[model samples]
Target: MTRRRGRHDGQSGASLHTVLTAVGANVLVAVAKGVAALVTGSAALWAETLHSIADTGNELLLFVGLRRSKKKEDLEHPFGYGQERYFWAFLAALGIFLIGGVLSIIEGVRSLLRPEPLSSPWVGIAVLVAAACFEGYSWGVARRQLRVRARELHRTLAEHLIRASDPTATTVYLEDSAALVGIALALAALVLHLLTGWAGWDGLASICIGLLLIAVAALLARRSKALLIDESAPQDVVRPIRDAIVRPDWVADVRALDVIFVGPAELLVIARVVPVPDAVEVPARDLVKRVDGLRQELLRAPAITEAAVTVEDVPR
Candidate 1:
């Protein structure tokens, strides 16, 4: 039997490993919070549990996307199933909004209406701390993966997290951020409930956390939509392609250039290249090969999987 290797052999494996770990941790945390909420009747604890469940679901979706997207190019999809990854990612974002955002708001409002008495403060604190530790570890794993890319792109970690072409990068970042924020909100509600003897504040905190999650999820959805709709290439990719095609000795001038992103790390470029006299002297076959080779080499840095080049007759 022939064994098939994954598309992201090295880097993608590490990413998948980390995300799986994160999902496991979130599941554990959710179970713990659900138990605690049941025992103590704390709205804050219940809200945290719901958020973790949503996060766990999103991670599973990401894993499915990562795996499905690795399918080899077939007759139907000559370009491969790369966009399958983005489509699954969009679904994950929507799940985050619906399961995490809407449900959380509803629960928070219910707590405000029925002010349940606070339970054991110590248990809530312990669960929050444990959840925090796991979340921090997951976030750390994602940060380490991004460090190299950030340095190569000459951008800070924050900038790369928001703008990187890879959907995994954005998904991981948003999930981690939401996890931490949710913990804070849970903690705040528990403390307020303990001090003021008002369960409504705990519910209010839950509402606030839900709003924050909604905003974050919306941002993620917008970005994924951009990718799905064939958004224009990022500056990092566009600038490099322009520099490569405009190099002297071969290209005299470029009359027009157009670029579109086909996948996370793939772009299709179409250009009108006016070759110099020396370039024009080459045989037609040789010129085509040379230009194709040049294109492949130029695109290597940006993870371009395929490049097509056409040599047009020098326009009159």
Candidate 2:
């Protein structure tokens, strides 16, 4: 299957669109949550405020990664900066863990130790409901993008999100999903606080939100780490590639084939192949020329950025 390069399409790409949608949502939600947190003095609202802020910053970092990764191949970097997405994404995840998760847990412990009376609890609830709408919209955008691609691959959305070569859209999708859940947690904390004169519920909710962020951050970091370490393409790509290598009648057998992801949707292929012997009638130059042509053909697949073929000389 041919995948279009995000750089080639500019901002119209799926990953870019998903990230932009998230940034817009988070900016507005963060402002609302911050105001509500101050008005209510609720631990849960404060934790959610931090979550929205971190998400906004993370999305912006993703934008930077997308832009930088688009730089055309240079002599210094022949493979292009496609993997820049992973590096920035890794950093973003780390930020969420430290800035969002760690601070949230600290805030929760502080609130638990010195329970503070909540003022204007209704206001916090109102803001959280609105925040849910905003976050839900952003999540929808990311979900639609994944659904389209997942259908193309005949894979479930969960399966595609985990294994898809591109992490940009998946990152947004996961963050937005978490945002929606966080809103619910904040709302529940507010309601429970009003129902029972207990600040512990509010503090516990904040801690739960922090743990949630940490889990998501860890998941994102693990995926990015694998990619940064040069993870291989999924089985679907490998199978098609193996078939393509020996499809030409001239190629008798593919002795060995290897494929590695160079970018989100780009791969490098190296293979050794034996050509069908024509009783030494075919010139070595012609045979080599055909083999090279086969290598070039691999470029037709959008995921395949480069390929190298070693052709066995025809028997004398």
Candidate 3:
């Protein structure tokens, strides 16, 4: 049995913390941006307001996913409701696309067709700067969590983001990154409108921010889809599990092994093993006991929530 534990087991609390922090920041930012958008009549500010609103709703969905994913196994769901997290996260991504990305693009096009003068440019600028600061703080919290986990897995930040089983953490990080960039675009557009008195620049910035959201939402959607479909664990985790199963002297060979990520920080392993020719001569009852013992030992790996082993005779 491999004794290596998964590093992510202890980070669930951190993921929840990151989600909560984002929810709080986005709520505050959304309200401020909405007021600024109404006051200044800036298309860019309006787009940003929509973006923040979508983000606030997405964060709430993530909170629901996190809570529901912790439900214990029952008669109906023998494996528990782990995939609920992925399902909700996927829905959140769709919300970003429909509510934030699509609407922003439409508003941008409408503004282009019929431009509107900005009431107070400085107010929008101040609001954008404050929003950026809040987003930066949230991004920092997510980045620190990813950094620690990536170091433990010996993977780069990009690799960890793509392969991490915990969707809440990754979603927050990506959302915050997009929010920061959107703030920059809105600020630039406001400045351009102020300098040139052309509202078209503001509309263009809104379009750009919409495109950014679309891209981020696509990436998150793909990741969540993969998780919902039961993606396999990485090779790094698979290899050690195989090594552990073959460690017992009674095992002559590991015929086959399969490991799948059933949920965040949980794995379902099924393995076929060939018993030593001499060991197979033991009574049938004893062989069953040995196989059960081996299964128990494999369960020691923190990520392996469930393991099933089948013993077979050595090849002639």
lDDT tens per residue, model 3, 1-316: 2323333446778988999999999999999999999999988889999999999999999999988877777779777777888999999999889888999999999999999889989999999999999999999999999989889878899999988988888999999999999999999999988899998998999899899999999999999999999999888778889999999999988898988887887898999999889888999999999999998988876777789999878767
Question: Once model 2 is optimally superposed onto the true structure by TM-score, how far is the C-alpha of residue 121 displaced, in angstroms?
Answer: 0.7
| RMSD to the hidden true structure, all candidates | 3.1, 2.7, 2.7
Estimate every model's Cα lDDT from 0 to 1.
0.78, 0.85, 0.89
Alpha carbon deviation, residue 53, candidate 3 (Å): 0.6
lDDT of 2 by residue, 1-316 (tens): 2333443363238788899989999999999999999898998999999999999999899999988888877778778788999999998899789878888898899999999989999999989999999999999999998898888767899899888777788888889888888888888888988899898989999999999999999999999999999998788779889999889888888888888877777788989887787713588788778877887788777567778899765556
Task: Give the clashing pairs for model 3.
Answer: none
- Tens-place lDDT digits, model 1, residues 158-275: 8887676668756876788888988988888888777888888888978887888789888888888988887877687678787888774687777777777666666667777778
Off by over 4 Å in 1: 1-8, 281-283, 299-302
Q: Assess every candidate by TM-score.
A: 0.91, 0.94, 0.94
| Range of the 10 consecutive residues with the lowest summed lDDT in candidate 3 | 1-10
Residue 92 of model 1, lDDT score: 86
- Candidates sorted by lDDT, best first: 3, 2, 1
